[model samples]
Target: MAGIGHITQDWEPVVIRKKAPNAAAKKDEKAVNAARRSGAEIETLKKSTAGTNKAASSSTSLNTRKLDEETENLSHDRVPTELKKAIMQARMDKKLTQSQLAQMINEKPQVIQEYESGKAIPNQQIITKLERTLGAKLRGKK
Candidate 1:
């Protein structure tokens, strides 16, 4: 066998490089800075507008007057006092507690309490249930 010849290979060393920012990146940076400044100005304008709105609202009582008139015109239909009394009387005659009456009518005890206190909005379904369970005429004439 012939003597092995020495092999020599030239290899360049690996080099990592960071690229310089391009024109597009510079333009993007400028756009971001402009947006930030405009955003701050927008926030200040919003605050100023809010302050002006509060001042304008104090000067204008039209909205407040309208709200008051609307509230005055809106009438809540609560359970009548006579119906409340009838419910209470019927429950007492049946010797049923409020919770017992509520259970019989498939309602919460608070419902019975509200009815008795005349705070409940008139619900036809609940009235029907109560009438059926109590055998009392809670609604309609007489």
Candidate 2:
């Protein structure tokens, strides 16, 4: 009994102390918050893109666009046919074939063909080249 007396145990609740937040820990928390915000922003951007694509897809069809293209073709056909003749004459005067002229101008031969055939019109830059190379004045130029 004297050597091994019963030890009285205090069953008091043990409180665990958490470490105080330091400046580095606060910085880490801020980085985590920034990452979460960035993730949310990315999700929002993806949703917006999906919505826009859906709206665009729903609005138009190929058949309607084709009809519009047909009207455009009709209007193009009405452009005076003399421009085509001028382009062809210019090429002939230069002793240049369509492919040769296209090479000189850095355009495709088909582009020259389109201009000569009056299927597609050339803009002012080409008009200048046509005049210079062909030595002929366009119908409406001064």
Q: What is the TM-score of each candidate against the true structure?
A: 0.52, 0.43
lDDT of 1 by residue, 1-142 (tens): 4688887899999999989657576457575587587783312224556535677676568878877778455667999888999999989999999999998877899999999999999998998998999998988685
> All candidates' lDDT scores?
0.84, 0.71
lDDT of 2 by residue, 1-142 (tens): 6899889988999899998667566458575587587784322224556536776665577767767778433444422577877677767877899999888777788878888777775577876776666678876753
True-vs-predicted CA distance for residue 4, candidate 2, Å: 39
Compared with the true structure, model 2 gives a TM-score of 0.43
lDDT score of residue 50 within candidate 2? 53
CA RMSD (A), model 1: 10.2
Q: Where does candidate 1 have its weakest 10-residue lDDT segment? A: 40-49
Task: Give me the displacement of residue 9 in model 2, in angstroms.
Answer: 26
